[model samples]
Target: MSPPHAVIAGAGIGGLCSALCLARAGWRVSLYEKAKILEESGAGLQLSPNACAVLRKLGVLERLTPFALAPQAIRIRRARDGATLALMPLNDAEARWGAPYLVVHRADLQRALLDAVAHEGRISLQTDAAVTGFAYGSDGVAVAISRGASRLEATGDCLIGADGLRSFVRQKLSPDDLNFSGRTAWRAVVEADRVPAAMRSEETTLWLGRKAHLVHYPLRQGTIINVVAIVDEDFQPDTDNFWSSHGASKFLEARFSRWDKSARDLLSAAPEWRKWPLADRAPAARLVSGRVALLGDAAHPMLPFLAQGAAQAIEDAGVLAEVLARGQDVEASFRAYQEIRLPRVTRVQKESRRQAVIYHLGGPAAFLRDAAMRALGGETMLARYDWLYRVRESPGQK
Candidate 1:
């Protein structure tokens, strides 16, 4: 008898990671993408230890380490004068969390996953093919696929909606729009030499101010610096072509006009900026509705304040593969996947939202928050995240 097959929609970070894990577990997989040309895009993202462990298991970490940097710590500063608020030491991250905390360009990480996916004979990735629909039977599913003008059908024991925030598959399962968070994230990459030496350090620097905050870190072996600035503001993000949206440098500088010279210098160093409005879907009641299941942003879209957006997506891929590879019923496995994932992802979502409020605090609140940071220091603050970094396997896997 042929081995069970799985069909996946959206050949993104989550989808690609899921394909790798499933293929490793003895499943034949068909991965589909809506774009004709599959090129990775996006700015920088921090992969906390939770993500690195799974990447190590998938064998993508080795390919990634060369292009990424393991920042020694996260330096939180006051935006008004660039004074340090707290230093969350991460130089010993690997020894403590069982994996390294890597800061990588989104494209580089995607490339690493794509490279691994290419070597797997059991995985078939087809660009320009979109999953238009799917039907779940008692044992498996039949998927409707579209590639430009042509249409075809593919059958598999399971279908995964790793599509993304505005997933077509998610629309079929649970219909809801992703609500904007009344904020905008502006991202840019500057040459390391263009900014002050501090911005080029092998540590992620976060400067927090009233109603705004900025994060900057070095990428690609410290040749370039990735800058991300978030402001409590508003914009109607273009749904169809959002990531490509560009912002004026003057507008960005004006927003940070009151910020410290150090902060403004880093912002000015960025020659151009691409922006996206932050948004999220509320935690779903369930991540699985049938053989069709949600993964990554489709399942739970959360604010980036926690830096777990990508990490959580990577976690979803890891858990989904483990559950399905058991060879049990597909829906049962998906339910098991949901049961394991829902609570954790929901907590991270709530914490991220709360952190956003804390980061943008003003006046007495801001001062107290800073004072608390100083009181706790780096090690204590780092200890608080142990729950998030530690990944416990399912009871059966153990």
Candidate 2:
């Protein structure tokens, strides 16, 4: 008998990861991307322990380590005075969580995934191929794809929507309005030489402030520092606006004018910036319908506060691959995939939204938050992620 086949839409972190995971599980995969060329436009992303374990299992982690930085810790500070509130040590994360916490440029990780996908004989990736819609009955699922002026259709046992926030595949499956949280994230990468040694250390530093927060971490093996400042303001997006849209420095300068000198200095050092409106969606009633299922951002678009957007997406890919490779009926496998993923991703989405508010608290609230952090200390705080960091590396694992 021929092996089961899967058709995937989108080629971002989630899509590419899905293809690699499925192929490793002994399934032939047809991955499609709407973009003629694949390029990750964002800055740095955190690869938590859970995500790292999955990547390691898929044989993609080693390719990423050269470009990935294992930060020693995450230092949380008060934006007004730059006072240390807590220090979460990550130096021993691999020992505690079973995998290392890594920070790397988004493009580097994407390239690694693409490289792995290219080498897989069971996987075929096609760019300039957009999945417009899909239909599923008893004869598996057929995807309608658009390629420039031509159209084509492909059949597979299942369809995985790994497209990003504004996914066409998602619109056809579980449609929900994207909530713009009256927040914007301005991101930039400053050369290591341009940043002061204190600001460019081997730790991820976070500054909490009034209606805003700043996070910076070293990337590219310490040659550059990725900085992101998220502020409270709703920048209504238009048709032309992308996730990483061109941003003006003046806006960031004015909003962060009253922050501590260290925060201002880091912002000034960035030669240019790109901003993205923070958007998320409520968990859908069902992530799977028939032979189709959603993965990554398409399934659960969460805020970046918890730094689990990519991690959760990676987790989704792992679980989806595991369930589908079980040799069950195609529709049952997709339903099983949803059953395993929806709850965990929903929790991360809610927690991420809560953290956003806590990071931008004002006057009295900010003080109490800091005091609590200091009292809690670093190790105590780190203990909270135990549930998140310890995950199943394979279908048979505990």
Per-residue lDDT of model 2, residues 164-199, tens digit only: 889887888766788787888999999989877889
Best by lDDT: 2
Q: Which stretches of model 2 miss by more than 4 angstroms? A: 239-242, 393-398
* Model 1, runs deviating above 4 Å: 239-243, 393-398
| Residue 367 in model 2: lDDT | 86
Candidate 2 local distance difference test against the native: 0.89
Question: Candidate 2, TM-score vs. the true structure?
Answer: 0.97
Cα lDDT tens digits, model 1, 169-260, are 88998798788898899889999988888678899999999999999999988999989999888677777764558788998888889899
The 10-residue segment of model 1 with minimum total lDDT is: 389-398
Can you give the lDDT of residue 198 in candidate 2? Answer: 86
lDDT of each: 0.88, 0.89
